[model samples]
Target: MTISAFQDYLNEHRDRLLADLVEACSIPSVSGQMDACEQMAAWVEARLQRLGASVTRWETEGGPPIIWGVLGEGSASILSYSHYDVQPADPLDLWQSPPFEPSVREGKLYARGVSDDKGDLMARIHAVEMYQALHGTLPLVFKFFVEGEEEVGSPHLAPVAQAHADELKSDGCLWEAGEVDEHGRYTMYLGVKGIQYLELRVRGADTDLHSAYAPMVINPAWRLVQALNTIKAPDDRITIDGFMEHVRPPTPAEEALVERIPFDGQALRSRWGLRSWLNDMDDREALRQFVFAPTCTICGLRSGFIDAGTKTVLPSQAFVKLDFRLVPDLTPELVVELLRAHLDRRGFHDIEIVPLSSLSSSKADPESPFVRKVIAVATEVYGHEPVVYPSHGGSGPMYPLASGLGMDSVTVGVGYTGSNLHAPNENIRLEDYFNNVLFLARLLQSYAGA
Candidate 1:
């Protein structure tokens, strides 16, 4: 079909397209909520089938099903990946509306997965539908693998990727989740950093003791604080042994791009309600470290206290959640090994190291021809210069795409900066939603024209 015809079709059915997206978003497909996982997958499968593609629900013994759909017949196929699931909605009271209700207010559609993933997935589907309605066929071959476990660390995706490597083969694959910059500039990202998430626990007394016995019984919370101190210094530099050993220095090209990137540290701090970054990380250094350096973060902590007022009780156990963001060439396994060694060497072998999730890093060359196509299309749609990220700070299951399928992945979507991703009041602007539909349509048409 022709691009103009497809655009006309999309505009003619704009309301219908928006309604379909809303219906899909209405499904509460939180992967953590196991029962809803299957329902969401079924909805996606049906939607793809309605779009004239053959659908398959690839099943795992205990994991949620992986929905797949295919269209057209060509050697060059685009593999589009998205997640049907979303993070659990906690702190419910903070939401302006019920998360699952899917309401529109002030030009924003409020829902848990609206911007994070479901919106992006719907855009591609709508694009395909528009082209089919116009020309009775797609511009290129297409395949979609919508996963159900992204919010929960994507534990089952590796096995799924390995098992269906040949079936999922394609010339290029787009990562599921992404967002525009604070200045309303469209940005395309290639690959993501690796991650090692672990929880540390310290034990002291056998049971909780009263305040009067504070001097006699040891405090596990204090011990946890002390251990955290050993892990990261006041300046945020990780003191863990061998943590920085595998860091690959930025290439001359990457360094030059870093210099070109317009990073406003003061603006970022104001957005996050912070006075300054840790250790006075100014604009240039902050952007450089965000892209290149590894990190150690304490996500959460638990200890003893009172319900309403202060209760001085020496807690028996204290727990802390730690995450390490890794750069290229550093696997999660190696980070864990180094963490264990660091603790053992520090004479704190008693502290338990419980792993939560580990993902290896993934990256693609920003200067590649395929990457330029992505940037060009994004700019055409958004009417702004698209920022090309060599690699983002977040972690995803993109390693297999880069290593197993031998294809670079790019993340481009309509999510705005204030979408409150993975948090309450999550939303996407109405304009972005419509723009994304146009972007996907133009992207598919670009290949045909090329």
Candidate 2:
């Protein structure tokens, strides 16, 4: 179980791993694209079977199946979570190459799902393969759980995990999508924020009316804007009735962890061409908000006359897509209840609240044995101390699968700062991919022996 043996195996099989990744990425498994998702699921099932895993495809009510597999037998077991489905590669013109065609350029592999979760998935599989090759048997029991609906907020993940809790329970879970920071330091996140995505719709008239009728007719667009304005104040505080009451401030230890996190606000401001952050907060305050504060964002807005030219017509209906990033103690169900009550109380009862998708937040103790093991292995593999984030700002289904199952989860991946996740030209460095194989191998060895 030495590092050199793992490295030797990776060196010998690097090309094969890359080829497998390319094949996996070639499938256009966009979240809602059932045909492609099924194709990708079949590919995963075949691959896992080839690696001697017992595979099961769990069918969702209306979504793609979840590919679950178990391999090897050991005293300790570990669950690896990743998703095969990717975000739709829209705005195709932005891509330098086709989204599904995996291409290697400048030592990086570029594809729609290459870096987000597919690459991570492939790396873990390769790690298991390499470990078995050298040790004659896997160091620990390994479980692979790859879902196809993560890009759509994993609407059914909670129920699926609950139903299969017995099978998914493990000593620790390895989450998807970790990355190297801009400073070339590998980073790990213990948990992720929760999200509540919903849309507010309003209607005023039966159909479009001439602009001249605006003086008499109530405009739904204007009404929607007024209602949106009430949810957040000009000071960037979420004024959704009772929303702030659920946002608990970071504990003293959490604050100390935040202080340790390296942040360069100036670099971010320069990259985004911004003069300052919201409310011009100082570095510590900004970092605190970045990791702790909940957000109210308008993801999309729609109404009549939104094309190239203005159609001088009054809009009959309006809708706004909103996402609320929740902190600890704030559940998605609570968000919907509070928002509906808030809108109704503000006399905008006509505005409909349609809950799109949601999942609760997840957090792990940084000092937990599982997290400490990850930090130690990452440090050894990267040859430097890894940047540790108590919790990532993004929302994911980590809660139900990890913390909810009474397991600690840590994220690790083959991405860098410029991986362009969920955007065009998503990619990961080949070196990082190979290095992660070694990292996972060592983690498995260490965990098994512990």
User: What are the per-residue Cα lDDT tens digits for candidate 1 across 71-137?
Assistant: 9665557889898998887889999999989898998899989987899999889877766665567
Worst 10 residues of 1 by lDDT: 1-10
Model 1 stretches with alpha carbons more than 4 Å out: 1-4, 90-98, 208-226, 303-315, 448-450
In order of appearance, the predictions have TM-scores of 0.90, 0.93
The local lDDT score (0 to 100) that residue 334 gets in candidate 2 is: 97
Candidate 2 global lDDT: 0.90
lDDT of 1: 0.82
The TM-score, computed over Cα atoms with residue i paired to residue i, of candidate 1 is 0.90
For residues 1-450, could you state the per-residue lDDT of candidate 2 as single tens digits?
A: 579988888888788889999999999999999999999999999999999999999999999999999998877899999999999998899999999999999999999999988999999999888888888677578999999998887878889999999999998899998899999889888889999999999998899899899999989999999999999999999998888898877777667678788898899889999998888898778888879989999999999897897689999999999999998889999999999999899899899999988889998877778888888988888899888787899989999989899998999999999999989999999999999989998998888883
Best by lDDT: 2
